[model samples]
Target: MTREEFIAAIAPAAVKLRLEGSPLFPSVRIAQAILETGGVIPAWNNLVGYKVGSGVLTPYWKGRSVNKSTWEVYDGGETRVRADFRAYDSVEDSFRDQDLLFDLERYRRVREAKTPGEQIKALLAGGYATDPDYAKKLDQLTEQYALTRYDKEVDDMLEQLMEQIRLLQEEVRALREQKAMTEIPVWAQEAVQAAAAAGILDTTTGGSYDFYRFVTILHRLGLFDAKGQAG
Candidate 1:
């Protein structure tokens, strides 16, 4: 599949994986996948191009393993090494298995990193990949594909939801106050007219406002004394 098609195919699972609270940013993960898969997506079914060695590649292991020649960088140079890479039944397992990295200290550091760049650096330092330009390549791919768009959209949706909740709460408060203002004694009404005529209330509503508003206005004007009852 084409790059765009490949990304679209995996985007849902990738975003879901990110929501699982993995410290690796979704964008970084996507970029890494793009780099690793590199036109071999369906052939390998390994989304992260996972290497075998965490005890899953032993001869008696129950999972699938594929022998392949990979560029192994060691001692300042690279050599093509034929090794067994773990295979998965589906792309989703490959994606989910990425969490296994958490078992490593460096992977934990990558998650603990405070920024995208730092996280990539942690991955490289932790020997997650051998390429010296691993971080640069991942960073460039992340920006190039605008992979962070998914995370940003999720964040924006959450913010809008919170704002709507806040507005609803305010409306409920207003309605409750409107309901509680059921019994303003006639004496209080007369007091309000007297206060307005005396220009002691801070109102431009022409005395045709809510009863609670009048009470608050008078309270603010010190007409209620300290007991909250108009004196």
Candidate 2:
């Protein structure tokens, strides 16, 4: 497939997977596929960073290696084989498998992230790839392709929610101001009466009948600031 066609085909799938909480970003996946496969070079559809084998040539891979070498073996005692790696049926299947890899239990943290950047960071931090600069590379790809633009709708929703919160706060403040104006005089008279009965206020000479003092006393009694820290 052409480079544009390849990216266009996978972009929707990537966005859907991301909305479903996938750690891998669409741009990163596309870039990696381009780098690994040379954008339709060698006529192989492999896009998941598959490497050539150490031996055991297969019909699918007719190319020869620089030098035949053997690598480590598994517990089954099967000698290491070196040759060209396997190919996939289509790019869509490759992308699907890539998403599945991230959905594994080990990568659960990435799948839980709410944003694409968070998922990308988590994947890099979790050592998902061998590249030491994987995070930087992914970030570059994300910015170059404007992948975060995919979240524009989500950002708009958040902005509307914030506007609603501000309106609600203004309404609350107006209500509180109206209540305070209507109730303060009555509350102040009750406070003076209580202070007089308790001999806390000097009524004989009207000494220290400060309105500010009454207001402070009301505050201390938790009557003025009913909202506590929220106020």
Candidate 3:
């Protein structure tokens, strides 16, 4: 996934964790998503790489799961094992699970930590991850992209931003409906006008203008004629 896509996907989860009063910094959690998922947004929606200790896919999980061969490392070294990782109905559910992990006794120090770095150190100390440099990697992803920006965006602000975006999309949709082929460049406009005059362009509409209709018009006028296939 692109950096922008990664940031957009995790922003809501980070903001929710912050608003819910989780002591873990948003950057800490956002970086965890990036590092754990290898920056790819999976269809399973397991945002934090949480694994199910039990191998079975019992109904108790309340979500789907996929078993994959995973690695485990400690001071003794590394070992590979197939494990069932937690699945979610959405990324937000997995994020909520991450917060629950920090509430365990092993991560008490993390809850008591003040700085982001200290919290990461506490997680490493609690053996939250198998990698020896887990803290350093989380820190690098946090600092390099300033993921903490999501921490400061509260729920109310997020709601307001989403509403504004929805309104803007509506406005753009309305504008497109009122537009005609005359709005195009002169060369393109003349071509479209000729097509319209020839009855190749479908002027009969149920008061709607969608991309599919536009493509159909182009095809009827012989403007889109590609015979190749795309994957």
Q: Which candidate number has the best TM-score?
A: 1
User: What is the per-residue lDDT of model 2 for residues 12-34, given as tens digits with 9 covering 90 to 100?
Assistant: 66556545555665555665555
Clashing pairs in 1: none
Model 2 TM-score (2 dp)? 0.43
Instruction: Give me the candidate number with maximum lDDT.
Output: 3
- What lDDT would each prediction earn against the true structure? 0.71, 0.56, 0.72
TM-score of predicted structure 1? 0.65
lDDT of 1 by residue, 85-134 (tens): 77877776776677766667767788787766788888888888889989
224 in model 3: Cα distance from truth in Å? 99
Evaluate model 3: give its TM-score: 0.60
What ranges in model 3 sit over 4 Å off?
54-63, 152-231
User: Which stretches of candidate 1 lie above 4 Å from their native place?
Assistant: 56-62, 160-231
lDDT by residue (tens digit), candidate 3, 19-126 = 768777777888888888888878778867888754444332465788977787866688898888887777877777677777789999988988778888998899
Cα error, candidate 1, residue 203 (Å): 34
Clashing pairs in 2: 53-82, 53-83, 54-82, 55-81, 55-82
CA displacement after TM-score superposition, residue 89 of candidate 1 (Å): 2.1
User: What does each candidate score in C-alpha RMSD?
Assistant: 7.5, 13.9, 18.7
Q: TM per model?
A: 0.65, 0.43, 0.60
